[model samples]
Target: MLYIIGLGLCDETDITVKGLEAIKSCERVYLEAYTSILMVPKEQLEKFYGKELIIADREMVESQSDEILLNANSLNIAFLVVGDPFGATTHTDLVIRARELNIPVTVIHNASIINAIGACGLQLYNFGQTISIPFFTDTWKPDSFYDRIKENKDLGLHTLCLLGKKIYEPPRYMAINKAIQQLFEIEETRNQKVYTTESLAIGIARLGSSTDQKIKVGTLNQLLSQDFGPPLHSLVIVGSRVHILEIDFMRFFAVDKQLYNEIVKKDYGI
Candidate 1:
């Protein structure tokens, strides 16, 4: 049997009871490290779960998956993911390969940023297509995601931008400030007025972690000035039609409550 388990959003303790049991029963355990990351290190998880883990980086998972699937038909192999197994399409492809090999598979689900972003008080149903913002290079700036964000904003829906992370390279994670700068560049080029420096945005860092988790609600210009420590950060663009209750709830995390209230009332017409 092959077990694909989600480690949830936080540290080792965030693993579900069923996931833990599956890991304990498995003969070999592999931790998928490229897709997303946990708050704690792999050593901490090994100590907590009392299981030795083999780190599966992008190269191993993408190019050498056959090795991972080898003997799965006879031996129990556990593939651990930082978030839900289905969060990344790569895992889906692995499941398909396993099925072709006649290997039975079991999936364990857990909380991911897709749903946990609701902690900011935005209605989940109000979110449109989520987009990822990759780190831009001087010669490789891509604004294709801008069209999707525009579509979401046009329909009065919120946009959730998942920043990119380069694990194998220098281990660079796209920060919210850089994301805002990219968005501004796109807006300037398109002139669609989708958003501006004064746009209401939310920046969340180290979500689901026990300590140093930060949430700041403010304009893009304001957020750029403030520091949100660490990686694994996400950004949200407020929709045009926001409920008063959401405004009230998000205000708790606002950098300037007065400015947030004014912007919501004047621009969002809440």
Candidate 2:
């Protein structure tokens, strides 16, 4: 049997009881490292789980999956993923491939940023399409995501922007500042005025980590100057038709509550 386990957000202890049992019974355990990461290091997880893990980078998972799936017909194999196993489409593809090989699969689900972003006090149902903001290069800046955000805005729905991360290389994590800058640049080029410097946004850093998590709510310009200490940050673009309750709840995390209120009233007309 092949087990695809979700490690949840945060550290090793965040694994579900069923996932831990599966890990203990598995003959070989592979940790998928490229999609997202845990708050703790590999060694920490190994120490906690009492199992040595083989790190599966993007290359190995995509190009050499058969090697990882080897012997799964006879022996139990575990493929661990940060957040939920199905969070990334790559993992879904792997499951499809396993089915083609007639390998029985078991999935263990857990909390991911997709749902956990509600900590910012935004209603999950009110969110439109979720978009990923990739690290922009001088020659290749993509604004396709901006159109999605605009679509969400047009419908009075919030937009969740999942920042990009480059793992196994120099390790680049997109900051909220850079995301806002890219959005502004896209607006300048497109001139649709989907977003502006005074637009309200919420920046979350190191989410699900008890010790280092931070939440900041303010305008795009206000957040650009704030320092969100560590990696794994996400940005939320506030829709113009925000609920009063959401504004009230998120005000606690606002950089300046008065300013947040003023902007919400003036720009969002809430």
Best by lDDT: 2
Clashing pairs in 2: none
Backbone clashes for every candidate come to 0, 0
Candidate 1 structure quality by residue, lDDT tens digits, 1-270: 999999999889989999999999988899998778887899999998889999988888878878898899999999999878876444866888889899999999988888888988899999999898888888997888999989999999999999986656634688888888888888898999888899899999988877777899999989988888788889999888688899889999999989988988888677
> Whole-model lDDT, candidate 2?
0.88
How many Å off is the CA of 189 in candidate 2? 0.9
Q: Write the per-residue lDDT of candidate 2 for residues 74-161, one digit (tens) a residue.
A: 9999999999876644486678778989999999998888889999999999999999988889999988998999999999899999
TM-score to true structure, per model? 0.96, 0.95
Model 2 scores a TM of 0.95
